[model samples]
Target: MNTSVVDCQKRLCPLRYLPRQPLSDPQASSQSASCVATSACESSALSFKRQAVRRSITPEFAKKVQSRSQVPVSRRSMRLQAIRPLRSLLHSKTTVSSALRPWGARGFASALVDKQVEGERITKVAELASEQAVRVTFEDGATAKFHKLWLRDHCRCEHCMHPETQQRQLDTASIPMDTPLHRLEVTDAGDAVAIDWDAPVRGTPCTASEFDAQWLRDHAYALEGGNAEDEDTAPYPKSYRQPRLTTQQLWAGADFQLPTHDYNKCVDNIEPLMRDLYTYGLVRVSDTPNSMEATEKFSKKIGFVLRTIYGTMWTTNPTNDAEGYNDTASTNLELLHHTDGTYIRDPPGLQIFNCAAQAGEGGESRYVDSFHVVETLRKENPEAFRVLSTTPLPYFTVDNDAHLATMEPLIRVDYAGNVVQFRHNDYDRAPLTHLSFEEVGEFYKVHRKLLEVLRRPETEFCMRLQVGDMMIVDNQRVMHGRHAFQGGDRALIGCYIGRTEYESRLRVLGII
Candidate 1:
């Protein structure tokens, strides 16, 4: 009930007008006069009025009125006020607890983390070159010296890179024994290095890291002034731009094989070979029997092995599947410089191809190192690179009706916006949805640029395989294509390996 209405009822009662106290202290005067008046009124005819009013106010209604008076001090309001500071304190406590955990205990958080902390931290071998090695101080205050030989061996020079090939041209013997390293100096730029060494006893500068003729003159000990600009010493991009496996590092074998002559011994080589593929995107096996059926058997073996881990074979079985309408597998010379399965979420981890025959003709297989292409694109066309890197192209999949398709972007990024993988296939491009026509045109333009880079003769490397030349690669990083074959009826067998087994096999061999 409204307080005004309650006051009106009180006034109407016979006891209401009896109190008369106008005093300096309002609280004391109202209490005393109201009490005396209440007693006098109860004693007289007003007693009937008091009893009626009391009877009208039910216990539940009185309780509700009392509850309304205590609204500001309710349990929910009190509880929320009580918990506000505590919630903040609890969050702070959790943050501190996580920070206190041991370095080794962090979860699979990142590969970069594992590589830096676990592998590079402890195993960064010391260097004793003429130049000063950069000292890597661990969290515990201990430091390790990294040498120029180590730098030279693991040079990221182009000559060492396998743009389209995975051959290790660095024979330790190739490093001159007589060459004396004077000192080692590392520049902050792109981790570049400058080394001063004694004159080569034989075969150019021995123990040189990415020895371009121009680089040699720039840092050469005996450079004549006039000979610097000579055509022979013309400035060229460093050969060390190529990627290479670190010297003396033995990788565990899982799938790929090096030059093992014995068949039984090849079993042990699998993990390292697989690790090489994981790290470098490619690996090779030599001296298998030369036959198309043999190649198929090799491919099938890889498939069967992969299925054990992946749980299902995801090969595009063109012969049996009606869904694979656009699945074209031909012996025809198509330079398919394209990635496989951009339509799927996680594409194939590894691709295994076995060469049936190499008739010594022009049907040599070509591989484009997409990773190297990415590096090149970054260097040459930074603006175009930024556009391609920022924009997303819809990677797609379709049913028999090309109209019915699902699409995702060709480039996938993490929450922090790091480019994780690139998935693109011309075959599975779905129609643009949110993007404008102009944006789509820009996408195609950049895409075509990427394709052109892939097809460049300098960018791609070709290898003619003899019978029994089987290769496995990280499918996401490498793109394979073939040349026009003059000889009749040549075929290669292929299969895919998923990443789970590919990695587990590496761990089993202790390579990772």
Candidate 2:
């Protein structure tokens, strides 16, 4: 070692110009001393002074250059630089990088390593090579052979290809079992290894994360079949404990003639009609005249009828105010879909509305099946469904006058957990809980998606309710919104009914 070398000190330190020591000439130090003071006493004193001076200079130099005291390298800093170059490489490239199935963007590489290394994900793509050539063995004494091309097609890694979303996007149905390959290669990938197919098929490209997902799908036993898109099982009737409706005989008559003059039959039919509303979420009465008195009478009768048992359950919409009932305005517009009484823990069971004046232009009532909305969501946005089903949300409702309002999540599936219902009025929702922040964006995302799907005119069973038409619907299951209209004095008398009354009526009728 060159002890006198100043490689460690490029700074302007006083120690830089110090005299060099030669170990071999230690005995002749005084004799060869540059200073005239070569006596034993002077030599020893000079040596002690030099040693003290060198120590003081080195510390001062280090303090001056504190930032670069150690070698300019660190695990994090190196990773940062390493990550920078990968940013440009992340964009899509047309050619197959190699035969690893696309898994994820560059960022997922580390996660893939962690998951696979811990044995959390496994590979089930056995029968590595076949075509009357190679044999492959897997755990559980299973043995199979696949054409070399089959093994090549199963390469899982980025650079080879990547999945567009959370899971792999490859559809292996097109890959025939007879495709051949000359060789295959496997390379160490930090924790989980990456497979490289020597004969890179023109279309076979994948990212590293997709490789992990594929392995997990094949080996982890966690993957499910029959539409991974369908996430929530609860919305389906079988998943919930609540008894589903057995018969759908509300509109069985093909005559198209409305039920107008049958008073006893009409009132008798209310039980089954409202019961159908509960099971299906929405129901309608065929023939009632469009008159203010008739509609109000129907509304009042339903409220009064249910009030006998429901008590406060038949209360007016929170929109009704202390000042007085103001029923002048009309909801005959392009109203959006929404669930009723979202704010209440037990939302109103039945909603009664009569068409008092149907002379208005285009004020057809539209109803969307919320269950269908659930199915559509499950098919399209499974992750969003997961977020919604798992998260509790907030919702709000307004009094008839629109002056007072209450809030809760339109979909309340948690505490009373099994029952699915909504209290949606995008315009009326106010905060009800603040448990998880992730739900803020998730709630809005799901609501927006549902709204988009629900607004489709096809989903809405639109009907022109004349002056005499009265309808009773399950407030929880059905979302009622009206189309825009002009010209006529469009008005309807609306009222709420209790769940207990509605259920009792159903039992009395034996329609359940």
Candidate 3:
């Protein structure tokens, strides 16, 4: 309602905004978000990459790189990315690198949130040993070191990246990993660097790439001298110099206020609601029409509802739907703190629940930020944390028509060891056959440990959802359930939204 999707996509689209490409399923967005996050992990991963380089380039460089290669292959093989441009300048008139311009776009919006503060331009270029990387220094003592293969892979020309889709066109694996640089120099204007490669990219002999100077500054991973693992990692930029949420507001019930907005007013704006939802994992809106129509309208303002076994729009009231729910959620039984769709590979990211009818007693809705819970587990019980994160468990839903199942760790984290998704639902669990005998015992032990942190009074928020009350929840990060109620009928109408769609709005608002 505040900013249209077209406006956001157009700003980033190299050409004109076109219809979004179709996704095969709801989880497609979640899968795609991982790829996007990995690509954007550049600036932060740089520090990690640099430490590996510093350790490997010993006085005995060749021997250490081989005999003493201690860095994990997973970390070493991670593609070091140049921060992507806000608007890919692939069509830029400059033809310096491989008939393409690289990571350039005037350093994003000149005054988005704040004036764009560009670092010093390229002052000098140095080719490090092993012919693996280049260090570009800036005028103001800032420096960025980039890998040779990474530079070739991220070239953003019409030949390398599709101009319309803004997706990579060049075959990354086909390119030589150690593509030697025939020549590398800072441009005369000091705003970009020009390079000529000795090996072919995707079998194309013409290997030349021009990288924007400001692009290098923002994306550059500065080298840090260290032979040991970093116990304390320095803070790194998360976006391409755009505004973003630096930290999630980990809270108990006391620190939150359920941000409320009337449905009528929300039609005019939804930014305030989104900001709160992203920070707190959930929020409540009042005075909404008690119908699925209103629920979907509110959902579409952010993104469309994800269709699943329960269909797009669903309800817990056994009286309302003829098909009837096959799950206990429709009954008057206390559901434990857990996420929905545990059987699906990528559980829904956001869940919208609009209470149409209320129960006179009990049936109070409950929520807990699993991110907060897991972080507590990390500190309070590091061993438990390791077990839950590394061990995989099976989840399943076997109905007459559908038999859905998947195996994954309960707490899914990213390369930086931050919680990305939480798939915890004891009720939906299948047999414990996925883990080894010893690991199975450990899983149960840690499961209890995690629940202890989860069920604490301060960590939970409980409220009886009332008529016209709507809740938006990050199902991936927040665990939600309800208490048993008897006397009055409790009905909740809701649907799910993918994580990809949720973060797209965050990007549009520059709040990622």
TM-score of each: 0.44, 0.42, 0.75
Q: Write the number of the candidate with greater TM-score, choosing between 1 and 3.
A: 3
Query: In candidate 1, which residue ranges exceed 4 Å CA deviation?
Result: 1-264, 289-326, 357-361, 396-406, 413-419
lDDT string for model 3 (344-437, tens) is 9988989999999888788999998888899999999999999899888899997648999999999887767878889988889988875679
How does each model score on lDDT? 0.43, 0.42, 0.65
Q: Report the alpha-carbon TM-score of model 1 versus the true structure.
A: 0.44
* Candidate 2 local distance difference test against the native: 0.42
Clashing pairs in 3: 97-208, 97-209, 97-210, 98-208, 98-209
lDDT by residue for model 1 (1-512), tens: 11211121221211211112123454554454344333422333223333222222223433333233221212222221222211121121222111111111111111101111121112122344455343333223334344444434543222342211223334445545434566544433212244555543222333334222122222232223333344232122222111122222222223223432322234323334544555666667776655545544544333333432223332222232443434443434455666766665567767776665453467777666676676566677765566676775566554445433335555444554444466666766666676788987877777777667666767665677666677776677677766766654455556676665454334323333
RMSD of 2: 29.0
Q: After superposition, how far is residue 137 of candidate 1 from its true place, in Å?
A: 15
Q: Please name the candidate that would achieve the greatest TM-score relative to the true structure.
A: 3
TM-score ranking, high to low: 3, 1, 2
